[model samples]
Target: MILTELFREQLAYFKDINYAKEIEFLKGFEASEEEIKEFLEKISLQKD
Candidate 1:
């Protein structure tokens, strides 16, 4: 899928999970995985 659409998918997924730290535990990310990882990373990092 297009990167934009992938990002949108990530953004749309913003609310379903309650914990951001959990996303960072994933690895071997290629495309959409970063969107999710980074999104949650942003959330987790921002709390500091």
Candidate 2:
């Protein structure tokens, strides 16, 4: 799956489980740690 689609699915999974932290979900992606962090930072910013 594409990065954005995967990210959205992960976010849905976390929401379903009421997860407070997203780092673990981000780790599930096939991306480098830095890339995951950058993506997470972007998502967080968009939420604010």
Candidate 3:
């Protein structure tokens, strides 16, 4: 699986358990503009 997919899976787990602090922690994870864009795209695909 791709790195983006990995992050997507993690995002889902936190979202499922209502982990607000985890979400904040994740938000703090610094990524490049390209990485952020790619990660968001993967997350969007998972939502469908």
Which candidate tops lDDT?
Answer: 3
Can you list the residue pairs that collide in candidate 2?
none
| Candidate order (lDDT) | 3, 1, 2
TM-scores of the candidates are: 0.30, 0.35, 0.35
| Candidate 3 residue lDDT tens string, 1-48 | 587666666653333444345223365676664575566666746832
Collision pairs in model 1: none
In model 3, state the lDDT of residue 20.
45
Which residue runs of candidate 3 sit more than 4 Å off their true CA positions? 1-28
Model 2 accuracy (lDDT, Cα): 0.52
The sequence of per-residue lDDT tens digits that candidate 1 reaches over residues 1-48 is: 466555555554555767556444446654466576787656543421
**Model 3 lDDT on a 0 to 1 scale:** 0.56
Q: Against the correct fold, how does model 1 do in TM-score?
A: 0.30
The superposed Cα distance between candidate 1 and the true structure at residue 31, in angstroms, equals: 7.9
